[model samples]
Target: MKLKLLSITLLLTLAACKSHAPDASGPGTAIDPPIRPNPRLAAATGFDFYLLNLSWSPEYCHSHPEAAECASHSTFVLHGLWPQNKDGSYPQNCGNGPGSQTGPDASRFSDIYPEPGLLEHEWRTHGTCSGLSANDFFSAARSAYQSVKIPSQLTNLSSQTSLSPEQIAALFTQATPGLSRESIAISCGHNYLTAVAICLNKSLHPIACPAVRSCRANSVRIAPPR
Candidate 1:
């Protein structure tokens, strides 16, 4: 009986050892990291942000200078990225995805306003393409984005500034206001909000941004103009 037990033990140990053996496959056969288009080096091929080789070029302002001036109450500032598409040489939508517009212009809601970079924690936790509700998504976007609210008074901000998208982003980093017009552009897609929210949440305050509607509902009511 003792001999039989000892044999069983040895067999078990040997099986365990074999199961734990590492693969002897060739080097570099391990799992590789997924490749993504380099955000920095990739050409701005979409209307999402990159347009005419420039970032944050608001088309409405470029087309109607007088309206822009009235809205911002100051001369528009231009930041360099790329000029709007000229001569109609580019595709109607940027090559990145569907719904991209091509032209030498942009609307007030051209880019994702309030800038990106909020909601890092939630995004890191949930990851991309999770089946979250629109309400939850909006909340998460706000929390991650760390964006400032657009004042109700700044109606013309959309067409007022000529600053490039990159320049607009820089201004946001410094807490400068009166530049961003739309606050947030939903047509750019939810990922735009997700990306910006994550970026802002990571860059700015560690604390998440509270829900906008919830705050408004609970606060004192401001009557609309008579």
Candidate 2:
């Protein structure tokens, strides 16, 4: 009788253990570990150079006529200073560092980043990865903008003009004493000249752009400011 009782107790213990055992194949049974942040996303200061994008306002305004910057009839407007890798890959939207805020002082940057939305977007996307505070980043952007001299031919275009990518780059290099053909790259959209991207070092000096593809069109139209 004692042996039978002992056997029943062992069976009961085995059933209890089986019931408590975790289900290996059951859906939603396992708790996944928290996801770790990507190391590339956290690399604020790890960049090869800076690409200062200057948007040709007329070309952009052709599509986005309602943009506030278009209202000013500017020539080349500040796009954003991007952190670029030597291989042409860039890091963007690095989430706020310790105590860092994504929103910059819009009013302070209004002259350059006329659209408040763009100001916030640039700061959140490109500016955060700059490893500088919003104010300092924008300040560096302003300085970078001032460094590039716009050729008179491009500054006061009352009518449309067509120029090859090489010619456009040449004009820039001629106008800007230190700028070189290798350091600048042109971007186009819908066969229209769009933006000029100039590569600069961390110190904001002109540098050679690595692995960047320039506009391939034989010729692109430059629209007049509206």
Candidate 3:
């Protein structure tokens, strides 16, 4: 895993350097590469897969009832769209963060993220590493979420129930085109289903991500949105 991450990082750096053309301002002067105080902050794009995390809003509200998100009921809300490596290595804060950095036009972020703070945090932590602008990052996240056809039964769920992780995965396969049970993973907390994750390629097409953790319980209780 370390080796793979290191290789990708190096490749991205080389790619960035390759983009700089020879100095044209001076006829005979050679341009020495500027030294970056923190190389990780340099813009670079490297990722093996996209992990679309769908947080079950009801479960989140149940645990953090005081949270702003708990004020309203939504069946499913985006947790994040993460760039992941096959070896389980991922990037974060790869470029400028929220303070001095301008991120994606977040006017529409509320539609997906429910919480305003989460939108900024996700851009700083994960979106920065995507080697894409904040707008592109958030747009990609939204598009990825829309690509999946969640099972209607789960979308309008209103009551608590129990089901195995495999059962959930099977339902997703039946719902989304070209998606398989192998592509979905269910997450749980305190014996309750908390989230569902699906893997996609950089282009947002369904793909298998390695080492995805799934709920191990034989069955987990589900909390429906109010």
Candidate 4:
């Protein structure tokens, strides 16, 4: 076990180092990610789990009414699909990928992530580290999200609802039979529910994440999408 853990750590360090090397492009130019024929990284390193961050659109829209996502009605939205190391350290911008990617397809991402640059940003930042291509990474994110159902109580909430972190976690756990109390976390800001992140292994199956934490608030108000 000790040797395996050490090997995982070393692999992670190497992958991280390789990714940060300045691109051959030029002194200040950003590196572009290779269009992968096969995107899934062959094996795991320090990245032992995934975090499917589902944001409550209402809470986000309530504060930033001018945000593009606020322009339309949405329920839960994809905040990010994060790769997390067992020890809690995670990778970001781990590839010599293009700084931004955009197009009609990106605009279509409004179905879930409505902000203008968010989809592009997420792909370049966190998605690159997943060892998946732009399409595959996003596909995996969508699959991870679709595999579970959002509790109806959280949807279309007309009034602010107060609940503890444990209560929020329980909703997710109950909705996804495969998920457990240990695999879910809730986060809040400005006294309102912001996001719920569920941990998964590379297979996108629920997994234990000792390092993931719940919201600090004993109770929080959740605002539905405006």
The model with the greatest TM-score is 2
Full-model lDDT for every candidate: 0.22, 0.69, 0.64, 0.62
Q: State the RMSD for candidate 4.
A: 13.4
**Per-residue CA lDDT of candidate 4, range 178-225, in tens?**
677777777676556777777777767677665766667777888766
Question: TM-score per candidate, in order?
Answer: 0.22, 0.78, 0.75, 0.74
Expressed as tens digits, the lDDT of each residue in 69-164 for candidate 2 is 777888888877778888657776676642255467888877787666666656766777787777777777787787788889999889999998
RMSD of candidate 2 to true structure, Å: 22.6
Worst 10 residues of 1 by lDDT: 19-28
Ranking by lDDT: 2, 3, 4, 1
Task: Output the lDDT of residue 5, model 2.
Answer: 23
Worst lDDT window (10 residues) for model 3? 19-28
Which prediction has the highest lDDT against the true structure?
2
Q: After superposition, how far is residue 173 of candidate 3 from its true place, in Å?
A: 1.0
Q: What is the C-alpha local distance difference test score of candidate 4?
A: 0.62
| Global lDDT of model 3 | 0.64
Q: Name the runs in model 4 displaced over 4 angstroms.
A: 1-46, 97-108
